[model samples]
Target chain A: MSAPAPKALLFDVFGTLTDWRGGVARAVAAAFAARGAAVDAHAFADAWRGEYQPAMERVRSGARPYAQLDELHRENLDRTLARMGFEGLFDEDERDALARAWERLPPWPDAPGALERLRAIALTAACSNGSVGLMARLARHAGLRWDCILGADLARDYKPRAGVYLAACAALRLRPEETAMVACHDHDLAAARAAGLRAAWIARPLEHGPGRPAPEPEQEWDWIARDLHDLADQLGAPRP
Target chain B: MSAPAPKALLFDVFGTLTDWRGGVARAVAAAFAARGAAVDAHAFADAWRGEYQPAMERVRSGARPYAQLDELHRENLDRTLARMGFEGLFDEDERDALARAWERLPPWPDAPGALERLRAIALTAACSNGSVGLMARLARHAGLRWDCILGADLARDYKPRAGVYLAACAALRLRPEETAMVACHDHDLAAARAAGLRAAWIARPLEHGPGRPAPEPEQEWDWIARDLHDLADQLGAPRP
Candidate 1:
């Protein structure tokens, strides 16, 4: 039987839509070339991705007040760049460019058309820890077709927090049941379901690399799909 | 010479974009007709709109905790429905529909194409206090092409606070200088400029209705457009 229709779908940005690992690697590769060095962009990408959680935990646990992802990403990038021996390769301008690459990540092959289809039905928006500015370019660059973008900054807290999910519903003028939170991460869906939003999982099996632990799907997600397009069909959105 | 383009455009939704004043009155007229009463929707719309600011200011200044526009609108709607002698005209269903009238607001005649054209050259988004869901519907209903939505909840504070404008810039990932905040209200633009965003004004001459203090486009806006279309032309956005 079909699930009840949602008023909106809030998608996770990093792995569910765009291939964050590959996207970050591509940008890292470009930066390396600009510096006349040949660094392992994949390893570099992995290193940056590795920092994702501990950074937020610092804020989540009240160890730090909220800081925007832009600043957090910059701190990690600065540290990683030095470790990678790309010494003095970036001045302020180059650093900003590398930072902006987050805004232009490529989407998964299935991302854009599915989003277009979803928008034709429920309102489609991004609900992610990525600051709004970062997510908007990623959508525009890869044609992800979000109807709106909701950033972590919206709630002043990161996902897994009930307030974050509720704030999204509050903004959309939707009750929790009227909204579906779609993400590849199990923790995200768990928190969403806890907050009363229906949940959908779009597995990006390659998010961490071929063998490393990929963020898994939640068993309680209302629907599951191989990617955004599959989830779009399950949601009964028109195929693009 | 043109003032350097402001980084973003803020909006005054009710009369500025959607003719809430007209539409609500008309919607209420239908709601009243269902009750066999001769309700002046225009007057009702005016009275309801009049109650908006002071209610918001009550929350803004901390006399009350922050409440969504949906809540504030509904509270005012309740008071006015009784005052209009339209008692027992609404139950939960009717009240829900009436509150959602804000979402179905029709755009100004000049709004849609102007925004589409503006998007071609500049990073355009909505900076309004509407709930994310309300703005989503407003944009959908009005064919507004905002790239990302910057609402009050994004900052956890309402307009006129530097935090609100600062949060919007942080979301767009643009410096306050690079982003322009556009709106029809003098106070909205003034707050944005004070918080570091460049400012543009579109005169909403009929905002408060005929001869109602004749609210003028008298602010020191860096770029004064007759409307969004004029602003698009001024910004060199490719005409759609």
Candidate 2:
């Protein structure tokens, strides 16, 4: 807490600001229901989310050229559907809509208000792996305002990469030290720290869904909090 | 107005959303006054702006590699001061602060509200030659909220370049035909049209100050209005 506040906070959107699992599952369930099919939407959502890292890895390793999250998500959705034995259940347009489910992900209960308070103290931007268009749609959907969108598209690289972190800071005209990377994942924070950025851990116990063991911090971050509201409080953000 | 409304509107920041002339002049006057010097701040602001295109052209024509607006603005400020016979009038730190005067450009009277209204109907973003950092700070200063920041730094090129327009649309996941370039300058609109985007002209009679002839439409554009409010009304944005 004694460390000076960062001039800006670059946030990891998926598990940090949003309840991606729950939101995607709900959308998946509705999509299936519309087709008179009853599938375990949570399992499907998990399967789709499972493909995320490897998809990004393909680009990160130079195995594939950079692709937007939208494209990756769509391809992953198709793969997930095929893996689940529902390959032909949805047509191209339906598949596209289902992929866009990521855009409608809901904010965690504390996210919107905490972000508002945090913005009063520092510039807040999404530094997710999601593309700018995806982030923009999601921000509108969830009522979470960002000063600007910065991530995969802008960086042409995904999270955990030094280039991604450095690119976001450079775009903001801030040195890594002047910006803090806030995320619910240890690996993201670890990579950010390695890239010379300050790190703040925001615990999201329900990020992977209920009954799964929650993640615990593996190392000291510049700031550690139970949730975003706690982080806002710790940062001395003004109350509404 | 026969064409479909664009899914996103890319704005030209310098003269479109904000009054760079008056704002920079005010800041220049304040900075000089602090040093007990009286000068024609407006002329100074004009000279600084006049250097803009030629400086950008250096990068555009590959005479210089890409540099953010901040760097270009700082260089221009120095050259302008030197040309005006005020070289060494300020220290480096002072010069840097004065260069940042661009970030505090005042919004046109109808800009902030019109932008809010337009946002209700479509995605809105800054597509100026300004760097993402400059646009972000300027938006905060002017109370103009953009869904995302796009332009020079993101595209690695300045506007009037086809890549700049196409890059902005690409970042939004929008086709050029699905987005509109909104600006006060005919040349910008002409470039945007040549790059396959629709165009809207918002006239700023006093953008260069009174006594200067207001720029008229040199050719047909998708939409034309005296100000942003008229543009919003023509777009059928809901009244607040």
True contacts kept of each: 0.91, 0.74
lDDT of each: 0.80, 0.93
What C-alpha lDDT does candidate 2 achieve relative to the native structure?
0.93
Query: What are the per-residue Cα lDDT tens digits for candidate 1 across B1-240?
Result: 277755555555665566778678778888878877787788998888878888888978989888888888999998888887766878978887887788887788988888777766666777778767778888888788878888577776688878888888877777888888777878888888888888887866766566766566766678887777788888877776
Listed models, DockQ each: 0.78, 0.85
In model 2, residue pairs whose N, Cα or C atoms come closer than 3 Å (at least 3 residues apart or on different chains), thus clashing, are none
Model 2 per-residue lDDT tens digits across residues A101-192: 99999999999999999999988899999988999999999999989999888888898999999999999899999999999999999999
Give TM per candidate: 0.94, 0.99
Worst 10 residues of 2 chain A by lDDT: A207-216
| Poorly placed runs, candidate 2 (over 4 Å) | none
RMSD of each: 2.2, 0.8
Candidate 1 lDDT over A1-240, as tens digits, reads: 278878899988888888888888889898889778888899998887778788888988889999878788887888788887765888988887887777878888988888888888898889999888777777778887777887477888888888888888888877999999988888889889989999998888887778866555548578877787788788778754
